[model samples]
Target: MKAPQGVTLVDHPLVQHKLTRLRDRNTSTKTFRELVREIATLLCYEVTRDLALTQREVETPLEVTTAPEIAGKKLVFASILRAGEGMLEGMLNLVPSARVAHVGLYRDPQTRAAVEYYFKVSESLAERQVIVIDPMLATGVSARAALERLKEAGARDLRFVCILAAPEGIEALRGDHPDVPIWCAGIDRGLDDHGYIVPGLGDAGDRLYGTR
Candidate 1:
């Protein structure tokens, strides 16, 4: 499916192929972890595609040359914890120098609302772009809460990245943070009765960690 404005569907052939394996219920923990990392790397490539670059003079073995280099402060990857960590290493592989911020939120069983327990971010977030990551955009409560907290901590330029998203979650996130662009590998059907992404990879955190 084509992504609407403010959202990017990373539909590259490689991402699609990996995503299929990722969705297979029979995929093992080791393989699932591997696929997540691989797809995360591919998704990171798309997210950083339009980064600003500055030309610099370089002296080659033969002659002087000009090379384009990424300019400005390092980027921030704010992982929404537990499942978000699955994608972190792959993103770090792409930008080893990028600063990492961890934001923790848990949903109340009864309320189904996000509760923030810990929040920490790098200095000068307003000066750098931030990419917030989570494996599933189920209810968007955690994502929305994280965005609010990030904004409060001075994140002006931000984007959201996920492996799968439900239509309800996407709408909720878009309504809350329209300025923050979203990138996802897949957008499945709407949320089910329990607010889980229907036809989605089951319980990403559990699948990633081999936890029930």
Candidate 2:
């Protein structure tokens, strides 16, 4: 599959294998949760490849040497509510010092529009490389809105990461915010009439939490 505008899909066999397990209806909740974290760790590795590094000098028992280390400025892991929270653990494992924020929005059943219900972002958003997480991108409304909030809070550098996406959502996000880079594990076909992606793993929150 072609990479989405600024988005990248890991597409490795390990990622694909874990995703396959995630899609299986018979997978136990504990296993599914474990797989999600593992996949997120893999994705986080790619996502942070460009993280700014600084040179440092280290002294060994025998000699002194120069090395590179991550800059003191930490990245921000922002999630779009309940489902997005599932991807946070893996990111945190890679970036143990990173801060977290949550944005909550639910689709209005009648109009199929995203409605903001809650939000909380780090006070240092402007100085951090903000990574927004969501498991699925169906319509792009929620992602767009969440980004708008982040921008309003003074975040400048931003990127979005998702487990899956649809053409409609990619187009919508690109049209709305061309500068924001997007990264996804895969891009499925399109959204169904009700705004869910066809052939999607189904409602991510429902599956993750066994809420259904």
* lDDT (C-alpha, whole model) for all candidates: 0.93, 0.87
Instruction: Give the alpha carbon lDDT tens digit for every residue of 1-212 in model 2.
Output: 68755778789999888888887888877787788788888888888888888999999899999989998688899989988888999899988999998999988889878899998988878889999999989999999999999999999999999888899999999889898888877888899988998787888888778787
Best by lDDT: 1
Error of 1 at 194 (Å): 1.0
Off by over 4 Å in 2: none
- Work out how many backbone clashes candidate 2 has: 1
lDDT (Cα, tens digit) per residue for candidate 1, span 1-212 = 55767889988999989989988999999999999999999999999999999999999999999999999999999999889999999999999999999999988879999998888899999999999999899899999999999999999999999999887788899999999889999999788878888788899999999997
Lowest lDDT block of 10, candidate 1: 1-10
Question: Would you estimate the TM-scores of all the predictions?
Answer: 0.98, 0.96
